[model samples]
Target: MQTGEHPQLQQQLMVQNSSGSLSFNSNLSKEDEEMSRSALSNFRAKEEEIERKKMEVREKVQAQLGRVEEETKRLATIREELEGLADPMRKEVALVRKKIDAVNKELKPLGHTCQKKEKEYKDALEAFNDKNKEKVQLITKLMELVSESERLRLKKLEELSKNIDSLQ
Candidate 1:
């Protein structure tokens, strides 16, 4: 007869109760126990599912961390090797520069010597040219003396021929 209570819902609950057919207090405890068992089972299944997901995530993270560690070690080794190789190359470059400096030092005196020799050769060439000019002048004078002697000899011969003709 209450305003909030529904007669149809109360009839449905009464038909579900089991014991004597007309009893108001029936076996509702068994139904409450079954509902509690069902709720507990559902909660346990959900907890198990959550635990499985957590384990899967943990495994993925561990694998990623291991990969990172391996890559870090590989990079470290490569860096060490590069540094090792660079050390010797650095020393070699320094040695080569030293050798080049030594060569430059050695060449400076040789360059000065070569320049002095070239100057001496030019002076010698100039002296030889002056001597050649004097020799050419002497040769010209000798040629003129030989020509005058030949002319005098021809005049003497002509005079002798004339004297002989007069005697005849």
Candidate 2:
């Protein structure tokens, strides 16, 4: 029977010797030799195919990594640009805040001054009203004195006229 047809030939395994050289342990017919050579060739072909696939997978991974790196750089640049955009506004906001604070500082004294002026105005108004009331009272008193003086003068003139007639 041919070695290819023999199940035993396919089952036999190649092994390493003490020195690590691969050697066949079993004595083989010529057919078995040919079968072993065929198996070796098949194994070598499979190994080459695996190496090629490994290289392809590695290249794909490297390409993905490169894309990730590029994206990372772009994101960093965008972040910087965003920060740059905010920087001007941040400075402007700070300046505006300072101006508002300054205005508020100025207004504080003005507010106090306004309150003081209002109090002064109220006091002055009260004084003016009191003076006006006093003037009215004085005018009333003057009118009463004038009325009394006029009554007394009329009575005296009548008495004088009667006395003159009697003397005549």
Best by TM-score: 2
Q: State the lDDT of candidate 2 residue by residue for 34-53, as single tens digits.
A: 77778767767888999999
Give the distance in Å from residue 65's predicted Cα in candidate 1 to where it truly belongs: 24
Q: Return the top candidate by lDDT.
A: 2
The C-alpha stretches of model 2 lying farther than 4 A from their native spots are 1-85
Per-residue CA lDDT of candidate 1, range 1-168, in tens?
232433443453445443335332344356544543454456568879999999999999999999999999999999999999999889989999999999999999999999999999999989999889998998888888777777777788778888889889
Local error of candidate 1 at 119, Å? 0.9
Once fitted onto the true fold, the runs of candidate 1 whose alpha carbons sit more than 4 angstroms away are 1-86, 161-168
Candidate 2 global lDDT? 0.83
Give the count of colliding residue pairs in each prediction.
0, 0
lDDT of each: 0.74, 0.83
Error of 1 at 142 (Å): 1.4
